[model samples]
Target: MPANPTLYAYLRGEILPYDQAFLHVSDLSIQRGYGIFDFLKVENGQPLFMEHYLDRFYHSAQLMELAIPLERSALQEAVFHLIDKNNLPLSGIKMILTGGYSLDGYQPVEPNLMIVQQPVTMPTQEQLQKGFEIITHEYVRDIPAAKTINYSVGIKLLSQIKAAGADDVLYHQGCVVSEFPRANFFIVKQDDTVVTAAQDVLKGITRKNVLEIAGRTFKAEEGTITLQDIDQAKEAFLTSTTKRVMPVVKMDGYAIGDGTPGPVTLALLEELLKLEKHSAQR
Candidate 1:
């Protein structure tokens, strides 16, 4: 067992105190917001879907032309090492690929990779049982396909979203819903068909797994979901690494269906919990 009282962070080739990890101001991630990251959940000190997360991480890096310094095996070793060092029971591991510090601040230097683990705080059971609310925005992200660290548009609209009595923002192009700020959005129709955006979304890990799980039992449609669809949805939900599967009660002042967690959403949530429960063993 590791005995460090402080948390450990991997920065490039060094593993040090989490607080001691630093990035230069000239780093493209800081100066130009050029970086990508992927998050995986840790349960019983075991990181779940690490390979899937890494595959997406590397894909995101490639899409951004960001070079990751360490190989996948080495990065996996580092993650487990960090987990052992911290000795946390349940947590989240976030892997970041930064465009390294440049002297001129405009050019991309060699990329830097960092791995850090933090305690996981899942959404409340009440929120899951009763469901949550969200507001919609008419905006699209730059490089929507890549999981870059640029969430300025999402973060900037936080206040407005909160003031509207909503938890997060669902982005859309015209009448079509794309995704939430940090989660993938989905809708279950009266006919029991699942619908979400296809082209302009992050294609989240949890989203992918949920599709696989739900597709086994329901019609999983990876296509456009319109605002009218939201209004007519029998149930709605969001998926993320930390959030898991959560029911969406309302969106943009419209009460989704009966404004409560529907049967399909609950069933999917149960399936998601099962997936999480066995992820460590796998």
Candidate 2:
């Protein structure tokens, strides 16, 4: 007999067994795919940059017209309670707010909130040095500012991505480059200026940290980047909560600056790790 599962989740106002956390079929999140979510990392029992994550979460709820049932302080307390119950030292915390159950299944009602904690592994140095490849797709997300649950297009392109021998897809509009399905894109210029798309992208927490770290050693700015700009760039990378800083050595089957992680990417990754360590200690 296998040991019983011990994982737990926070649903509505109660902390319950993970498997018992459920939402009705009439929820707009299920019927209309209306919802928003935010994820943050926890290290050594400390949630990193929690306030920043909460700020984004509340902002997303407001944008989606979904009201969070709990106050900010109450939500924070619930998160901590969930963390303590799960007791996962190194993990990722996912906060999900969904359109609640509705009789008509077309209009917004009381929103459902759920939080889950799961173990996560950080990337190794070898993996970072080897980097990964990405294929380009000409599509953009709906409501790119809010962290909505509508990843239909990205999910539908999984086969295409794997068929092309790529790890992910980079979305673009004609020649204008935007971002990856789950990460924000960045490139290094010949003059060492770091640039990422300024519009039509979800501003990721890790992306913000990278910009701040890069600003100390190089010129970091957000603006429009096109395929032509990437073609002439010296290096490329992507950032997200899970990926941290991942080098993009190839795009659309072409080598990006020797097809390996560059100095700028590696330096930024080191500084990011340092920042995560310091932030976790706080």
What TM-score would every model get versus the actual structure? 0.96, 0.97
What are the per-model C-alpha RMSD values against the true structure? 2.6, 1.9
Q: Pick the candidate with the highest TM-score.
A: 2
Native-structure RMSD, model 2: 1.9
Clashing pairs in 2: none
- Going through the candidates in the order shown, the clash numbers are 0, 0
Q: Identify the runs in model 2 with alpha carbons over 4 angstroms from their true place.
A: 1-4
Error of 1 at 89 (Å): 1.4
Assess candidate 2 and give its lDDT.
0.91
Candidate 1, 65-164: lDDT as tens digits: 9888988888888888898898888898999988898778878889988998888788888878778889989998999888999999999998998799
Predict model 1's lDDT versus the native: 0.88
RMSD score of candidate 1 (Å): 2.6
